[model samples]
Target: MLDTVCGGGGVREAWGWWGRTLGGPVTGPDGAAWLRVAHSPVEKAGGKLWTGPEDAERLVPEPVPRPRLRLVRQWTDGGDAYKAELYDRVAGGTLASGPVLTDAPSLPVAWWSGLRAALGLLSAVRTERTAVRQAYLDRAMPKYLGFLDGGGPVPTTAPAWSTAHGDLHRANLVGPELGILDWEGWGSAPAGYDAALLHVYSLAVPETARRVRAELAAVLDSDAGRFAELVVVTELLQSAERGDNLALVPALRRRAGEVWRAFDGR
Candidate 1:
């Protein structure tokens, strides 16, 4: 399949959920392209984004100037059993060289610029549906509001909502040219939601977190942004209690404390 879509020289070097990714030099094309093959219905939210090129192109607006998807081919059998999308690959490397981050990382100016452009555009734009909703943010799953209530009233209300990238970690972004990969989660969410999520994820590296906070001060310092922080912290706390990403528990707790204090201890 890799050879068929990307020509013979292509190789399967990367992989994703329920599928594998192939990328290599495109013969006679003077460049490279990518292919993703997925099987059947991906019940997970945002699963459909990978199966159709039109969906991505329609949902993610042209925040061009930034490294993003340039669709080449999108084909499916019109059944829930098979789907695939081929995209023109970006020469720029991802935001982080590796998949995981534990230390303070340095990002180039292009990365910052691309991030600002893409996020700024999306933030102003709106989407009808988002995986992250008020219910998901304040879910009763491991309960954080109780603690914040200090044995008093714990309001389950949320703040103003806006468009969000849903997931915007280092792994999903590219650098040099600064490309933001993966648009499955792109939709309307809390205005400061994406920034808060990025900052929380960067908590393992204080310097990086500080850098994000400074660069996105307008979003992170506002009431909407602070509410978004609480949402992410609550989600992380639930995951920690569930024994997932336990290594990040300490950092998440610290982030939660900071968010709690910053949000008037709400």
Candidate 2:
């Protein structure tokens, strides 16, 4: 029998207790097993403490098996699917998307596959009619122009438009099977959006970055400039959506200047 409790933010806190009850090890790629525990302020006491184990059954409605031993706790508010995708309970070797690029042999196949996927995303975006483009542009262009100079190379003129994951950063790609997660922000973008994100994340290791870029460039038949522009635009939009975190504002400003230069050359 599952018990349930209702409160402001104690849902996650209560769920942790349930994980402890199962006695299963929760691990990530780092090989360290740890439990995700949550603590919140006590309503009346104005203090925080660990929610007791008794509250576990109440907080989680039913136990749902995923790739790991995870419990699917549904919120009565809405949606049939639970809010979280917990995978720590699983014993498989986890591979994070970005960092692993350095460990591998820099296979051309991986780069080509990723490039094809990126182009596919861009193609979807281009299929939109004038009105749809204007709608998306209206919401996206203001933020985009802010990153560009007076005259800039627009990503729309690129030769090979492809679908993009929009947010193809390292954290989104994970696992040994290279399963992509966090589809909420996905959409069609530019050809190089995924490659650029992957490249930027790999800046720490120059060798890996070079190899990945080479692989990507090799797969494309034409217009590297257009693909690169798309990457810049996608990254700029991502920065805006993320509240322009990580000093992206200045970077966007710089990219705008670069785009203007590129436009002038064309």
Candidate 3:
């Protein structure tokens, strides 16, 4: 299907990183492009994940450093629905090899500055789409953060809200050039949500976590920022229950307590 769309473009490499998405680089007639294919049950194909990138392309501005989405094709086979998207190939590698950081990456100061600017610009864009729904927070926060000792009441309402790259993990962030990939969940979230998510993902490496805090302090230290940290911790704890990011569970719990103290104290 991709070959039919690419019109004889040679596939450079192909790999399935996420559960539902398969993507890699291809040398097309126009130039190098990334081809991503996602599959879903026919009944569930029209949901958010299926259409997020396309919506983001139409809604988000170009200066955000995300690759330009060029073409998309959708089709169904039996009970399965498939969609393919081709985007301009971005240069440089992800800040970390995967979603979680194990070591501190030596990023240029300019890269950090660029990230701050990109996130700020993104937050200013108006969008009706929501990344973190209040309903989910109302339901998930108490259920997950309930396990934390000394953790006070979980606040379902955010101090403020803004746009975010909902899943702002290391793997989605490319450095040396600063590109944010995986737009499957970009929309309105609690203010500082992106920075908080990045910090939590960097906890395994203390230096990296500290660097994230120091670099994104303006957002991470605010009332919304502290709340955002707990929000992220709640989500990670829930993910840990499903056996994902198991190693970070302890850190997430500890961080949840710390954030709650600051959140309640302030």
In the range 24-136, model 2's lDDT, one tens digit per residue, is 23333444332333223233211111221212222212221113323333232332212222334333333343332335433346534644554443345432211112245
lDDT of each: 0.64, 0.40, 0.87
| Worst window of 10 by summed lDDT in candidate 1 | 21-30
Error of 1 at 137 (Å): 2.7
In angstroms, how far off is 204's CA in candidate 3? 0.3
Clashes of 2: 13
| Per-residue lDDT of candidate 1, residues 48-154 (tens digit) | 35533345466667763333344445455444444445556776666654323577767777678678777887776655656476676556523764565353443
lDDT for model 2, on a 0 to 1 scale?
A: 0.40
Best by TM-score: 3
Which stretches of candidate 3 lie above 4 Å from their native place?
Answer: 1-18, 149-152
Alpha-carbon runs more than 4 Å astray in model 2: 1-75, 78-134, 146-162, 175-177, 200-209, 218-244, 248-266
lDDT of 2 at 87: 33
Residue 76, candidate 3: Cα error in Å is: 1.0
Q: What order do candidates take by TM-score, descending?
A: 3, 1, 2
